[model samples]
Target: MFILTLSETECRKMLADNRLARLACAKGKQPYVVPIYYAYAGDHLYAFSLPGRKIEWMRENPLVSVLVEECGHGEEWRSVIVDGRFEELPDRIGHKRERDRAWSLLSRHADWWEPGDLKPVTPPLSKYEPEVFFRISIDRLSGRAAKAA
Candidate 1:
């Protein structure tokens, strides 16, 4: 596979198109990776989740690695990897706002918000009161783009 550096515009495009990312966090020697839905605003990545296993793990360890990638037909692909620290936002109102923002992003890409039964059954913030929202402050960001030869 060939690799080329992605420009800022390219990086933003990739971020805008891909709504799902894999977040990798480690505590001590063990590492954990989980798929998350994220939204990019300015220079930060935001994601929301209810208090769960991942939230507990992140509370114990804040450092993380996130990967967002897109692969199309003919092997054309792009990916961005971010290494940084994650801060969990505890404000309930703020968490709700960010959760709405993330859902908006998903609605744009997928049919999750479509006008039908296929749409999300319950209100986005109903079950998750003590929601966990995080902002990833990117310490290092790198990307690659490649096309099939």
Candidate 2:
């Protein structure tokens, strides 16, 4: 098998083709990662979620990373990593346009509200969790692919 580096175009294509990714964020010295669904447009990865630990942590630290991977039969696989900054699109006058754009992008897929809008099976604190729309402005993107010789 051979492992090769993917070009920027390939990396972006992977991002565009995939919706699910592993989002990683840090707070002080602690690091947290979670699976999230996103939409790739321009230079950002737009996503939605409810108020939770990941959201709180990301608000404190906007620096984040995302990993998207595709695995095929046998030893074929491709993975892309994105280093980015987080920006929130709140439901307010100033962000109405951005929020609408995010909604439009996210709604393209079936059941796009899922996981993000689903209430926790067991309430963490029995508090209302509001939906959040945000985007990860990609700073750098890198990828690798492995295929049989």
Candidate 3:
């Protein structure tokens, strides 16, 4: 098998073609990673999530990373990594345009709402808070692919 580096275009294409990814954040050297769904548009990746540990950590430290991967049979696979800055899309003034864009982008996918908006249904809870919107402004994107010779 052989491994090759992917160009910026290829990396962006991989990110665009995939929706599920792993987002990594850190708080005082303790790194946390979780699977997330995102929409890639322009130079940013948009997502939805509730206020939680990851949100808190990202708020404290805007630097973050996202990983997207594709796997094929027989040792054929590829992965893309994005190092970016996380920024929340508040509903308040001065961010309406961005918020709208994020919504538009996220709405493009049918499974977009599954990641962060899911609520427990087994016990039947009455109160479940809505998810907030955020985006990662990509600073760098890299990718690698392996194919059997």
Winning candidate number (lDDT)? 2
TM-score of 3: 0.92
Q: Estimated TM-score per prediction? A: 0.72, 0.93, 0.92
CA lDDT of each prediction against the hidden true structure: 0.72, 0.93, 0.91
Q: Which ten residues in a row have the lowest lDDT in candidate 3?
A: 118-127
What TM value does model 1 have? 0.72
- Model 3: which residue pairs collide? none
Model 2 misplacement above 4 A: 123-127
Residues 6-86 of candidate 1 have per-residue lDDT tens digits of 987777777777768898987778988877777777677777676665677778988889999888678788899988888
Q: In each prediction, how many residue pairs overlap at the backbone (N, C-alpha, C within less than 3 A)?
A: 0, 0, 0
Top model by TM-score, which number? 2
lDDT per residue for candidate 2 within 27-117, as digits (tens), equals: 9999999889999999999999988888999999999999999998899999999999999999999989988999999999998877777
Greater TM-score among 2 and 3 belongs to 2
